[model samples]
Target: MALHWKLVIDTSDAPTLADFWAAALGYEVEDQSTLIDRLLAAGQLDDSVVTEHRGRRTFRGFAAIRHPDDPFDRDTGVGQGRRVLFQDVPEPKTVKNRLHIDVHAGAEGLAALVERLESLGATRIREFDKGPAGHWWVMRDPEGNEFCAAQ
Candidate 1:
């Protein structure tokens, strides 16, 4: 059987980073407001651990984004398929990522794709080009995590 999984990234600000990735990847930010409200009503959650973003309550240290077409729990807004979760951490990122996301540019081509990503708060770090092999750009998200924009 195939195992389920989601990528988890550590950030200083979960909500902001989640928003940036959601836009960059064309994913939807998970809405956990209903679950938050329910938990609060049952006293299973404390108000201090919650914060409002985009007018909805969410956990202060966690935020997530999921593929728009994927199945998710309506009551909890947790994705059952492709997803990424951002979590707040006290330590700063001091080294390169051991793993990274590679975003391929489709019909729009690399230039347009890079432009769109930049508009969404991604910064181009460097470019790579191999004669017949490939061409791509290294980019950093708002939080300085590395990812590739490939052609």
Candidate 2:
């Protein structure tokens, strides 16, 4: 059987990064308000670990995004398919990422896709073109994490 997985990224601000990725990937920000509330009520969680975002209570220093069509636990709002989690960290990013996400332009075409990403706070680093191979751009997200935008 295939193993289940989700990408976990470290960020200075989890909610903001998660929002950026959700928009970039057309994914839904997972809403864990129900689980948070339940935990709080049962004394399993502390109020200090919660914060409000988008008018809902969520775990502080943690956020996640998931593919819209993926199955998820309704009670917990945890995705069972393609998902990415962002967690807060004290140290800032000091080097290039060992692994990075590659975003395809799909029906929008490469130029339009890059433009859209820029509007959403992505910065173009450089472009690559290999004669019969492919074309792509190296870009950084709002938090300075590198990723690829490809046709």
**In model 1, which range of ten residues has the least summed lDDT?**
128-137
Whole-structure CA lDDT of model 2: 0.97
How much is the lDDT of residue 114 in candidate 2? 98
Residue lDDT tens for model 1, 4-65: 99999999999999999998899999999999999999999999999999899999999999
Regions of candidate 2 where Cα sits further than 4 Å from its true position: none
Return the TM-score for each candidate structure: 0.98, 0.98
Q: What does candidate 2's lDDT look like per residue over 1-151, in tens digits?
A: 9899999999999999999999999999999999999999999999999999989999999999999999999999999999999999999999999999999999889999999999999999999999689999999999999999999
* Model number with the top TM-score: 2
Quote the positional error of residue 24 for candidate 1 in Å. Answer: 0.6
Residue 91, candidate 2: how far off, in angstroms? Answer: 0.2
